[model samples]
Target chain A: MSPGPARGPRALTRLRSEGSSPEAIDQLLREQRVPLVEGPICTFLWRGDADGVAVDHRMPEIPIPLPLRRLKGTDLWYASVELPRGARIQYRILVRRGESTESMNDPLNPRVVGEPIGSQSVLEADGYLTPDWAYPDPTVVSGELVDLRLPSRALRRDAQVTLYIPSRMRRDRRMPLLVVHDGGDFLQYSSMATVLDNLMYRRLMADCVVAFTHPGDRLREYGASAAHSRFLTGELVPHIEGSLRLRGDPRGRVLMGASFGGVAALSAAVRAPGFYGALLLESPSLRFTEATPSGTFGDVFEPVVRFVNSVRAHPKKVTDRIFLTYGAFEPLAVPDRAMAEVLERMCDELRVMEALDGHNWINWRDRLLDGLGWLFPGEARLIYPG
Target chain B: MRQVTLLGPLDGVDLAAEIAAFGVDGPVALVTAGWEEGERNDAEVDRRLGGGSRNLNLYGRRLDILESDPGYADAERLLRTQIDELRELYLLRLRHALAGLEVIRRRFAEAQRRPGSELDAAIDAVRMLDETHTSSIAAAYEHFYAQNPPHERPAITRHREEVAAIVAGCAAIAIAGGHVGVLNDCLHLGHLAALIEERPLLAWSSGCVAVSERIVVIDDDDPAGRPDEIYDIGIGVARGMVALPAATSRLHAHDPDRLAVLARRCAPSVCVLLDPGDRLELRSGRLADLTSVGVVAEDGQVLRGAQAA
Candidate 1:
C-alpha cells in the first residue's frame, strides 16, 4: 500500500510565529528537515508510515498519551509544543502503524543524542547552541579508554567500568580520580572522553583518571542503595587504587553521575564521608513522591527521597566541593534547587550551573569543564604550570 | 591548611602591633594590589613589620607588564571589555528584576499575604541570572588564559617568580585593602595563590573579600541603590565566608529587609561584617577554633559571640 500524492498546495502549513517564510518552510518540509525557530511553539513534523505520533519529554507536569494530528491530504504527522525559550528536548516519534510498535528517533532530525536504551533526536528551540567544547575535533589529542571489571559482592555481580586516561599522563605523576556512575551511557552518548581531552589540552581541567561505572540493574541499584554505596566506596575505590596508581588523598577524588546515577553518587559520598573531595550531580532524582510526566519510569518513590533527605540532614559535609547542574526545562529543576539549598551549608564550596536544556547527555557533557574547573582550579592551572 | 587572619580597616587597627603578635621578625610580604598606585606610604607598615616589609607592588607590576607586553595587554583589554559588557547587562537585568520584585512586594502587601513561593521563585530567577553572567565571565577568562596563559607569558612569569621569592622569604603576607577589583586582578595575574602556598596570611577589607570564595560588591549609598552584585569568584583560599569589609558604613544594617537580602543572597557562606578593629582567624578556608564575630543571622540581626556568662 503506497502513500497518497507525492505533493500538493496544502502540503505546507505556514506557522506565522515561527518567523520563517512559507516558501522556506515548504522547502524545508519537502526535504524532510526540522525547522529551527526562535519562539515558544515548535511544530515537529514527521512524514512516513505512522498512524499516530507523540512526543515524550522529561517534564513531569505534562500528561502522556498526547497525540499528534495528521495533516489533511498528506501523510505528514505533526505536534506543536510550547517549550522554554532556549531549551533542548529529546523526543522520539511513536509510530502507531504497521509492525513498528516502538518509539523511533526522528530520522529527519540530524541532531541525535545516544542513551543506554536507544537514541533520541534532539530539538534545540529558540536558537540554542551546542557548546563549542562539547563537539570533538580531530586536531585535539584524545584520551585513551580501557575497559575493566570488578566483582561486587554487594550487588552479587560484576560491574564493567571504562577508565579514561589522558594522553598527557605520566607514570610518576599522581592524578586526581573521578568515578562517574552511568559510565557506559556517558562514554557513548555524552561525548565525555572528547570533553576531557579538550579540557585537559586547553588546561581548563587537570588530567585525571575517569572511571565510568556501568550498572547491572540501574533502576534497582541507583536508587540510593546502601549496597551500591558500599560497592562504590569499599569495593570499587580500593580495587581501582590497588590496581592503578591514584593519589591516595581523599582531596584527589571526585564522585559524579547524572539522573539516577546522580542519586547513586551522592548516596555513596554520604555513606563514606571524607572519601572524595568533590561531587558532580547532574539533574539528580531527589524527589521520589511523584512520577515523571512521560511515564518513563514506574512510580517508585521512597528510597531515593529518603536518601536525599538524609543527606540534607547530615551534620557535616560529605565532601569539600559540590557541583550541581540542572535543566531549566525539566521538572527536577525545583527539587534540584531545594537540594542545592540543603547542600549549601553541607559543603565548603557549592557551584551551580542551570542550563536551558532538558535532562539529557548533551547538557551533562557541556557542564564537565565548568564543574571540573570549579572543583579543581589549582590543579587546572598546574596543567600549564610555569 | 594555611593560617589566615582577617582584620577590619587597617586605618583604625594598629598595623605594627598586629604583625608583632605573629612573631614575624623577617620581612613581611606586603600585598598592596588593592591600593593600586595609592600604596605609597608604607612607613607605618614597615615600622610595624620591623622595617623589613617586602612590598610586593602587584598593581604597579601588572601595569608595567601591560605597558611592556602588547599581547598580554591586548588579551587583558579584550577580557576586561567582555567582562564589562557582561556586567552592564547583568546590572541592567538585576535592576529590572528588582523593580519587578518591588511591584510583587506591593501586591503582597496590598493583599495582606506573605510572599512565599512567589518571592522564592523571583529570587531564584535573579540568582540564575547572576549564575549565567558569572559563567560567561568565567568562560571569557578561561578562553584568555588558554590562549595567553600567564605561566607561558614571560612578563607574567617574571612577576610570579619575583612574587614567589618574596613570599618564600617573608614570615607573613599582609594583603591590604584598596580597589577590590584591582587587587583581585593583580593577585590572579601574579599567580599569588600558588606562590603563597601555606603562608600565614593577614588581610584587611577588600583583601579579605578578594581571598574569599566569591566577591560581592554592594553600596547602599550609591545613586542607583544597586542590590549586592556578586562581582567575582575568588581564589577559594578563604572559604565558607563572605567578608563584607566596611559593612557598617556601606550597608543599611538597621533595615531588616536589606539585611535579610544580604544574608539570604550568599547563604551557607556566613556573611560577616568586618568593622574597624575586628579580628578573625581563619583556618582551612573556615573559621578557626577562635570565636567568630560579626555573623549575620537570618533574623536580620548581626550576632556577636556570647561569652559564657
Candidate 2:
C-alpha cells in the first residue's frame, strides 16, 4: 500500500543451483513454469546455445540489463536474481547467438505484456495475480470496433482512431465517451477491448463510446502539446459529438492516459477546464520541482515538469472525478501521490489505489476496473424475471 | 398470512400471470414509488396487466401528501441525516470486521489442508458483523419512529389512512423495483408494510429489498473487489432472505468462494439469486424453492431445491 516495492522473506527452498545438466534443466522447466519466482529469488531460463544472454528489464530502482551465464557443459543458460516480493517487471530475454543476435520473448514463459514498442515477457513476483475480469467472456454479446480516421486540421494530418461501440448501444442510449492517449499500446497490451466487454457484461461499468487514439511522436506530442489539445477538443470531440449519440455533457466524457500520455490528458483538462468530467490517470509522470522525483527519468519529462509545476502553483478545478492508480514499485508512485493530494482537494471525488507491482502495461491493465467503475457506474438493468 | 412471491425484474410482464395464479379477479394495488419522479407512468403496467388488473397507486398519493406537509419533511430530513452519519461509522466497522475475516481466509488459503468447520466458523463471524451492522440501522429507524410515528401524526395520519383505505380495497399488491431507497422511504411514509399484511404480494428487484428485514446492496459482479454496502434495514414483510435480482448478469454465481461469502454473511437468512425468469416464494419465514433456484451455501457452494437454508 505504500509508495515503494515490498521486500519479502527468502524462500527456504534455496532454489539457485550450479552445474545443471541440459536434461535436468528441461525436466525442471517441464515440472514448473518458466521464470520460476521463489520468494526473494527469481530464476530465469533460456535454452538456446548463445554467445551471450542477458535480461532487458526495468526494475529494482535501477535500469540495467541482467546477464545470464550458460551452465557448465550444458546448453541451458540461467540467471537467478533477488527480486522483492510483488515486483512485476517486464523484460525481453536477449539471445546473442554469435554474430546474428536479437532480443527475444521467453519461449517457455506464457505470461507476456505488450506495448507500442513491442511485447515483453513478464516476470510477476509474489502477490501479483492476473485479474479475472481482463479476460474476454464468450457469454456476453460482443461490441464492435470500427477503424476510423479523423482529419485533424490542428495537426494537419489524418489521425487513426479505433472506436468501440457497446453491443447494447442504440440511438436512445447516450453513453460516456472515453478518449485514450497512446491508445494503440493500451489496446495491444492492456487487453482494453476484453476488459471493457467484460465490465459491461457484468454491469460493473456503463458501456461507453471509446475512441482509442495513438500518437505519432508520443513523447513530443503528448508532452502537454497545445496542438494535441486542439485536435481533441476542437476537431476530434466535435466530430464524435455530431456523429454519435453521446451523453453530450462534461460529466459524460472521460480522458485517460499513462505517463507522458497522462501529462497530455491533464494538460488537456487544464487548458479546457471542466471539458472532461473524469480523468483516469495511471502511473502518471507528474514530475515537478516541488514534487517527489523518485528518479530523473529522462529529458522527455521537461515539458511535463513545467506543466505540473504550473498546475501546482495555480491549482484550478479541472475534472470532477479522478481515478488514479500506480505501482508501488514504480518511480512515479511519489509523484502520483502528490498529484492525487492536489486532485483530492480540487476534484469532487478522487480514488487512489496501488498494487505491489512495478510500472508496466499489465499493472495499468489491472487497474481499468477500479478507474472506469468509479467514474461511470452502470445502473442495474431492470429485467423482470417471469 | 398470504404467501409472498419474490420475483426478479418484471421485464416480461409476469405480474398479471403471477396475480392470476392466485385466482384473484379483483384489482392489484401497484406500488411504483421506486420509480421516484416517474411513479405516475403506469401505461406500461396497464398494457402488461391488461384490462383485468386495475392499478391503485398508493405511493403517488403519499408523495403528494408528504411533500405538502412541512412537519413530515423536516422529520424526514433529520432522519436521513442521522442515518447518513450512522452509515459512515458502520462502513468503518464493517471494513475492520471484513479485514479480520480476510486473515482467516488467507490462513486457510495458505494452509496445506483446510478443515470445513473452521471455515464455517469464519463465515459465521462475517454473518455476525452483517447482522450487527443491520441491527444498528434498524435501531436508528426505530428511534426515529418512536419520536415521530407517521401513523400517529395528524399531518401524516389523514393521508396514510387514505392510502391504507385504497390498499384495503385491492385484492393483491405488486411492488416494482426502481430506486430502492425511494421505494423504502415511501413504503415507510405510507405504512404500507403493515397495511398490506396478509395480502398476496408480488415484488421484484428493489421491491424485494424493501420487504427484506436487512437491506444490503450486493455486487457479485466483482467477486474479488469491494464488499457489500450495508443499506438501511427493509420492511419486515419478506424477512428470511436477501433477494439478489439480475443475478445472472451481476453475480459470479459459479464462483464458490464468492457464493459462500454472500450466503454466509446473511446466514440462517438464505441468499437467493433472482435471475431473469427465476422466482422464489416464502411462506411462514421459509423459502419455498419451487423452481429449483440456486441459493448460496455457507460452505462455498451454490445449493438448489431443498438443500437451501
Candidate 3:
C-alpha cells in the first residue's frame, strides 16, 4: 500500500535459541501454514533441501537471491521478511545442490497464482482481500466474449481481438470502447470478463465494449513498434468503429496495457498524439539509459528507452487523461515514478496508484476497477456516485 | 405555522391513525414517485395511511413532461451533467477525507492521551468540506431554477398545476421512499417541497433524506468500499435538520468517532434518527416535539430531549 522499507515482528526469532527441539519446529510447520503470516511477518520454511536454499521472488528487484537461513541443529530453513499490510507476493524456492540450482514452488504452501508459463507460490499477508467485484455472481448478468479477427496491412498479420459485450447488449446503444493489449493473458490470468460482469451488475461502473488484442510477437511488437501502433490506429480502429455501435472518435476510446503492453500504448499515443483520449498503463517498462537497451529484458528495450527518454526530455500534452499504476516492490517503480511525474504535467487529468506488490497479473487485475471506471463512467455512476 | 410530522418507514404498521392525528380528515395525496414504475402499488401505502388515498403519479407525470417539452428536457439534461461533474469531485474528496477520519480515531486509541487539538481540527476540516459541498450543490439547483423556472414553461406548468390541484383537495400529503435520487427528482418536478408548506407532510426512509435540508446518503458496506457521501440538496422543507430514517439498524451508533463526525458535519442541522415507533414534529425550522426519537450531540453521543438552541 506504500513505498517504504517494511519492518514488522520476526515470528521465529524466539526459536533461534538452542533450547528449540525438532518436534516443536515440526509442529510450527504442520500446525501453522508455511510462509506463516503473523501481522506483516511472513516466515517462509523449507524442510528437504540440499546444500543451500533461497526465496526466489519478483519483489525488491535489487535483491536478486534472497537466501533462507538453516535453523541451527535442524534441517528446517526459515526466512522472514516484513511486508506491508495486505500485500500479496508470488515467489519460487531456489534450492542449490552443490553447484547446480533448480527453481520450484514452495511445497509447504498450497496457494498458487497462475502465469502464462507456469504458476508462482502465493504469499498473502493480513489485509489482502479478494476484491468483491471479481467473483462470478449469479445475480450479475455476465457478458459474452466473442472472437474477432482483423487483417493488419502494416503488421502483415491477422490480429485476434476478443470482444466483451454486456449480456443482452443491443446494437443501438453507443457505448465506450476499451482496447486492451495482451488481452488474452488478462482474460486467462485475471478473470477480466467476470470482473466486468460484476462491475456492471453492481453499478460500480458503466456497461461498455472491451476489445482484447493478442500480439504475435509480444516482445518485438509491443516494444514501441510503429507497425503495431499503425495496425491499431489505422487498421483495427477503423474496422471496430465502422461495425460496432460506439461513441464517435477518440473521446470514448481508451488504450490499456501491462508491462510491454503499456510501452506500446504510450508509444502509439506519443507517435499519434491525442489519438487516444485516455491511457491506462500498469508497471510499464519505462527504464531509460544513455547508452542503449541492453538489460535483463533484452536489447528489445531500445525503442522503449528512446520513447521514455524523449518523454522525460520534452514533456508535452499527449492525451486528455492518463492512469498509471506500479508496485512499490518492482524495479520498474523508479522509472514509473519519473514517467508519472512527467505525465501529470502532460495530461488534463492524471491518476497514479502505488501498492505493496510486485510486477504481477493480480496487481494489474485489482487496479482495473478504479482506472477503467474513472475513464468511461456509466449513467449509473451519478445514481451511486460513491 | 403549526408543524409537520415525520416518522420511520411504514412497513408492517399503517399510518392512518397518524394522518388522522395530524388533523387530516379528507383523502390523503400519496407521492410514491420514489418507487419509479411501482408508483401504482398504492394499496399497501393506502392501508398504512388508514383510509382514502390518491396516488399522485408524479414519476409518470415527470416522464410525460420530459416527452412533451424538448427544450425543458434539453436544459434539464445539461444541468444534470453539471451536477454529475460536481458529484464526481465531491465523492472523490469525501472518500479521502473519510479515510483520514479513521486515522484520527486510531490515533486517539493508540495514544490514549486526552484527545489532541490538532487531530480535532482535522475532523473539523472534513465537516467543513461536507458543508461546503452541500452549499455548492444547493446553489446549482438555485441556478437551474433561475434559468429555467418550471412554473413558467408550458409543459412543466401544466403538470405542476395538475399535481397542485390534487394536493389542494387533499387534507395532507404522504411520501413513501424507494430510490432517493428518483424520488428527489420527481419531487422537484412536481414542486412538492413548496406545495407541502400549507399541508402537513409525512415521509419516511429515503423520503426523509429527500425532504431534509441536505441529502446525506449513509451506505453501510464491509471494509467501507467508498465512504458515505453527501448526495445532493434535498427539498429543505424540514430546515436545519438531517433526517436518518431507520438509522438505528443501519448506523453504528455506538462508535463515538463516527457519531461525532456525523453530528458536527451537518452542524446547526440536528441529526435526528427516526426509527420504528419514533415520531417527530418540525416547527419554525426546529424540533418542536418528539416520541422515542434519538438525536446526535456535538460531542458524539446519541441523546434524547433535543431542543433547538
Candidate 4:
C-alpha cells in the first residue's frame, strides 16, 4: 500500500538543528527526490519503496529553510550541513505532531542516545574533543627489568630509563628492548608497570624490556631537541645494559612514546636501527614548526618524515618493526594518524605493519593491553574482562 | 581469612589494597594518619598480625611526619630513620632470597647462547623462577593478613551512627533501603556511598547530578550552551529536589539560568536546602517534616517534599 504524503521540507528544518546547512539540506532533498510543499510554512516530503513495499511516514517537512529531517531506522535524525563557514551557531530540535510535543524517543527516528531523552546533543565539528586512538602498549615484564640513563651532549640533560625484561628470551638468550620516552608519566599515568606485570603473567607477547626515559622538562625537552635522541642512543642503552644486566643485541631493542615523546622515539629509532629494532609511536606532535618563536617543526618533524620516506624508498639492511596508534579525540593527532597510514602503506609493501586504536586513554589502554597480549603471550590465564 | 576492619582516618589503606591486588606480595605496608589510640595502635596491629611470628610485618607511620607543622623537623628526622631501617630490612631479605635465582638466570642466558645447550631446559628454569616469585609474594601477604586482624574493628553501633548521619543529611523525605540506600544517603549527604543499585556506588561529579532529576551537573567548561550531556537521575529519595549544599559559593553561578528553570519547573513544590553545616531531614515529605539544623535558603523558599508536591 502507498504511504501518506511526503514531508521533505519539514525534514530539512529538522536537519538544520542537527548541524546541516541549507545548501546541504537542499542537496539531500534533491538526492532523495522528496516533494516540497509551499504554504504559510513551506513543507517537503519524500516517499520510497524498499523491496516493492512502500515505507510509511518515511516523509519529513521543513517549517522554514532549516536543514532538518526525521530519519527512519533511528530514533533521531541528523544533518551535516555548512553553517555560514566558520560561524558557530547553537541550535536545538523540538518534535511536534500538531502542537503536541513528541518525546525524545520519537516513534519515528531511532538514533542511539548516550544520554537520556529531552536533552539535545552538542556537535563539535572542529575536532577538539574528537575521539582518536593513539599510543601502543610498552611491553615490560616484572622479573626482566632494565634501566638506562642517557645524557644529551646537545641539550645537556640526563634522560632516565626503567625497562622491563620480557618473559620470552630468545633461543640465543638475547631479547628485544623498547626505549620509551616520557618514562615517569608513562609508568604512572598509563599504568605501564601494571600492564607489563599482567602481560608477563599471561604470556601474550615476546618478553621485552622497555627503557622508559622521562621527558627532562616536558615542554622544553621534547621538540627541536636532538640532544634527547643523542642521549638515548649514546648514553641510555649502554648504561641500561651495564646496570640492569640486559642483553645487548641490536635486534632486541625498540623506541617508543606518545605525543611529543612518540616523535622523539620514532626519530631515535629511525636514526639508530642498528641499536633500536622497533618504533612504537602514538599521537606524534608534528606541529613543531607551527608554534611561533621557533619553526623547529621543519628541522625536527620534516627530517623524521624524510628519514622514514628514505628508509621506505631504499630498503635498509636491518629490518625494523613499526607500530603506530592515535586517538580520535585529538585534532592535532589527525595528521599523525595520516602519517601512520602512510607508514602502514609502506610497511604493507614491505609486508610488516602494526597499527592500533587511538581514541582516548580508554581505547589506548585497551589497545595496549591487547597488543601486549598478542606480542608477549607468556602463559594463558582466563582473559580478565575489562 | 581474619577480617581486620580498620577504624579511623583512611590514609593510603585503599591504595595499598589496590596495588597489592596487582600482585605485589609480602606484608602490605600502610602509612596512616595514626589511630585514635595514638602510637600504641601501631604496636597493637603489628603484634596481633604476627609481625614477630610468621615474618609478616605491619608497619604504620604517623601522618604527622608528612603534615605541615612547626615540630616537623623532629618528625621528619624520626620518619627518615624508620624509612632507612625498613629499606635496609627489605633489601637484605630480597637479596638473600633472590641470590641463587640471579645466578640461575645468568647461567640460563649463557646456556641459551651456547652452541649445544638445550634451549627449552634453560627457558623452563627461568619461567619456573618467575612464577614462583610472583605467587610467593602474593601468598605471603594473604597469610599475614589471615593471622593478624586489625584492633579497631567497625562495630554495629558505629555503622548505625554512620547510616543515621547519612539519612539525616537528606533534604527530601523517604527512607530508602536495599541498593538504593547507600545511593540515597550519598546524594542527600556528601560522603561516597559503598552501594547503589546492587553495584558499588560509582558516583563522580557528574554521577552525583545523574542521581537527581531536578538538578543536572552542567560542565562549567562546556563551550556549547547545550545541556545534552546528562545521564538518568538516580533512584535516590531526593530525585525531584535539587539540594545545593554550600549554595552561596561562586561555583553556583555557572548556570544560574538552568538552576532557576529547574526550580521554576518544580514550582511551589521546589525545595532548596542550603547546607551551612548540619543535617536536614524530611520524614513524610511535608514542610513541617523538614527539620533544618544549620541550613538557610537564599533565592527560593524552603519547603518540604510533601508541601512542594
The pairs that clash in candidate 1 are: A60-A293, B16-B48, B34-B178
Residue range B227-246, candidate 4, lDDT tens digits: 21111233342333444433
Compared with the true structure, model 2 gives a TM-score of: 0.61
**Candidate 1 per-residue C-alpha lDDT over A1-386 given as tens digits, one digit per residue, 9 for 90 to 100:** 11112232232444333434545556666664473342565666776657667666664455464466666555566666566666777877777766555677876688787776778888887767777778787888898999888788988998888989888753324677899999888878888888888877665666788899998888779999999999988888888887776775686789999999998988888889899878999998877333444223344546787666566666468887789999876878988988887777767767788887778888888777778765543222111000
* B1-309: candidate 2 lDDT, tens digit per residue: 576888777657456788877676677778887875567777787556644344445556555665677676567666665665576456556666677767777787888567457766766766776777677777877888888776667857887777777777778888888767667777877787777686888888788888887766766554224467657777778877877777666665566766667777776787777766668887854566545466777776767666653
Instruction: Sort candidate 3 into its docking category.
Output: incorrect
Report how far residue B24 has shifted in candidate 3, in Å. 2.9
DockQ of each: 0.02, 0.09, 0.10, 0.01
Q: What is the TM-score of chain A alone in each candidate?
A: 0.79, 0.81, 0.91, 0.51
How do the residues B160-238 of candidate 3 rate in per-residue lDDT, one tens digit apiece?
A: 8888999989988888877677788889888888788888877776777788878776644322144556778788888
Please rank every candidate by lDDT, starting with the best.
3, 2, 1, 4
RMSD of each: 16.7, 11.3, 6.6, 25.1
TM-score of each: 0.51, 0.61, 0.74, 0.32
Summarize candidate 1's per-residue lDDT along B185-245 as a digit string, tens digits: 8889878777656677888878888888788876654422346788887776788888887
How would you encode candidate 3's per-residue C-alpha lDDT over A223-339 as one tens digit per residue?
999999998888887788788776645766789999999999888888778778889999988878655445744578877887777888898887888999998878899889877
Residue A248 displacement in candidate 4 (angstroms) = 1.7
Model 2, A199-291: lDDT tens digits are: 887667877989999788888889998999889988888789789877667877889998888888888888898888888888988888864
* Clash pairs detected, candidate 2: A383-B9, A384-B9, A384-B10, A384-B11, A385-B9, A385-B277
Query: What count of clashes does model 2 give?
Result: 6
**Comparison by lDDT, 1 against 3, better one:** 3
